[model samples]
Target: MTYDLLIIGGGINGCAIAREAALHGLKVLLVERDDLAAHTSSASTKLIHGGLRYLEFYDFKLVAEALRERERLVKAAPHIIWPMRFVLPHGNAVRPWWMVRLGLYLYDFLGGKMTLARSRGLRSSDAAYTAPLKGGHKGFVYSDAFVDDARLTVLNAMDAAANGADVLVGIAVESARREDGVWRATLSDWRTVEARAIVNAAGPWVHEMLGSLGVNAASNVRLVKGSHIVVPKLYEGDHAYILQQPDRRIVFAIPYQGGTEIGTTDVPVERPEDAQIDDGEIAYLCEAANRHFTKQIAPGDVTSTWSGVRPLYDDGASEAKEVTRDYVLELDTNGPALLSIFGGKITTARHLAEEALGKLAAPLGFRAHPVTRARVFPGGAITDFPTFLTQVRQTWPFLGEKRAERMARAYGSMLAEMLAGVQSEADLGSDLGGGLTELEARWLHDREWARSPDDALMRRSKVGLHLTPAEHDRFSQHWAALFG
Candidate 1:
């Protein structure tokens, strides 16, 4: 059977588009080469914020849209997405206080303020706040949001499937061509499907997708590699710090999964798939973090590291960080109507989807309804996160408070569904260490399309960062015995 839309990538953009289109009464098919969010999506810094730095590039429209979406995501998925206060400490070479304040003021007013707190200045004398830096450093606290990027992608795909979209994982597209009026696409996963229009939301491989279809538009993608390191928690509170480097790039030290998450360098890359965290990048990150905080973190302190390529739109910026974070969609109406997306932040994926579909509607001949604005995602059915926590406590009283809270944050209301048949912690079965249970593994494998141990540990859940080497080996053996 033919579908009205075929999404090439299973990253956040593709999944969001699939969910949006499916909800709008269109037949949709989404195919991914690897597991969902295995590439750039999962490797993100995992922030759902308006690009505060994008203001320097004069991308007020993009920042405004992203800021609004940030608040929307926080409300829509309270379990996974929440407000985060970012502390930006001023350095000698950084922007002036008046400029920073102006930017923050515009940011607060650009997007219609809702639940998130407004930006403010902090004094060094505030005893309630611990000064991680030397004296004479002022701070600017602003609003942002954090999300489990990998889980967000999966949940979007799951919502699309629930809404009647054919979600196909581990399926690679071999070829796609326009035939007469419809597009014929062949798959490598022992299946072939046809669609009227194709969305080349392949993230870093967007240009490659267009090349596969022999379509050439204005090529404007700059593959910049960004790397992150996960270490043990260094701070006690939920606030994250934005550290300024001497080179003018900023690094983030955020609280992640009860640990400290730090990242990101912007180096130009030749290929997207070749992105990896090299020794120099790690050292650079550590040096940047150490420059701002009293606690010095060495390479050994890094429990885990990941790298991703950002497909940024080249605007003739000499520095990678100066490149615009806004996304641009190029629509070719000649054959099969290819929609190629370039450079988008994770915070604005939903808005990108809406804008993309609006452009493709006339060509595809499908009237898609607008539902994503008010609709909640798969695990976002509830509004109050505390109420959900109370219900979960009542259901699984045997589970420890921390474990229950972790599961609820990760799986939301679906925690009950995931742990439905289990009565006690022992019933959850063998411990894979790092709070990972055998029952959770089976559920991820059976329901979440987890094929390998890395898929289970790194993407589906971040248990890999906490697992001991021997425990990880044992879990790999168990996974091989069951799947291989």
Candidate 2:
């Protein structure tokens, strides 16, 4: 069958573009080689933030746009996206208070601030903000949002499919070529789909897709690998910390899945597939976290670690952190026409989708309306998150308060659908360890296109980080027997 567009890579960009196009009454197909968001999208710091440090590099416009997008996403997905207060622990080596205050002022006003709170100062003696820090530290609090990046991608694909787009996971695009007036793309799983246009939103594999299409465009992407480590919760409350290293790099110690997530070293990666957390990178993250927190963290304290390659645009920046996070679109409209995307952040993925659709409209003969701004994602159709939680509690009174809260945050209003016929805790099916019920696993496999146990445990749900090796192996055996 022929589609108006075939989007490669089921990451955030591809899913966003597919959703936009599908909502515009166009036939669309999205293909992902692995599970959606198995790579960079899931491995991010998981913040819908306007990089506060970007201001040091004079990335004002990028920060403003990201801030605006962050507000929109929080409003649209109240379940997964919520406001986060970041505490910038002051040190002698880091940028001074006045300069940091100026940057925060611009960040507050630049995005035409709405919904997000403005920056505030916390005194050294304030109990709410200063209890977890070491001596010789002041604090500044600023606004941003946190997100379940993997779930966000999955929900986007789910929204696209609900809007009549064909969402295919575990399908690799083996080759693509211009045939007559359309692009004849052969898929590894489904070999017979044609499209009027193709989008190379392959994240880190973007250049690889372009090369496979025989288009030797200029090298535009710089693969910088960033890694994160999850440790036991170090501080109280929802507020997180931003620590500055002696090397001028910064690390985030954010509250993650009931634990403290400290991360991200920017090291240039030569190969995308080979990106993994090495010993030195782990030491770097641990040391950075140890700098500000009173409790020191070692490699043994790390519960889990993940790595992702940022597909940043190469703008001759001397340092990887200085690379621009702004996206660039390359439209090849000569024959069948293909649009290639480079360098975008999770905060700006929706905007990038709108821009990409606008570029592909004329070529595909469809004018996509701006539905993303007001449209709700799969479970975000509800009005308020707290109200949705109350409703879930009423529907499944058997679930404990903590598990109910977790389910609402992860699946939103869809928790009812997930727990449809489940009456008692036993009716939810066998426990897959790590508090992951069998009903949730079935929902993932049947509806969310989760093929493997890793997809269920790792990307679809982060319970893998908490599961024991024996429990994981037992669950995997059951999952393979049922779904494989």
TM-score of each: 0.95, 0.97
> CA lDDT, every prediction?
0.85, 0.86
Instruction: Kindly give the number of clashing pairs for every candidate.
Output: 0, 0
Q: Can you tell me which runs of candidate 2 are displaced by over 4 Å?
A: none
lDDT string for model 2 (70-95, tens) is 88899888889899888887863467
The per-prediction CA RMSD against the true structure, in angstroms, equals 1.8, 1.5
Best model number under TM-score: 2
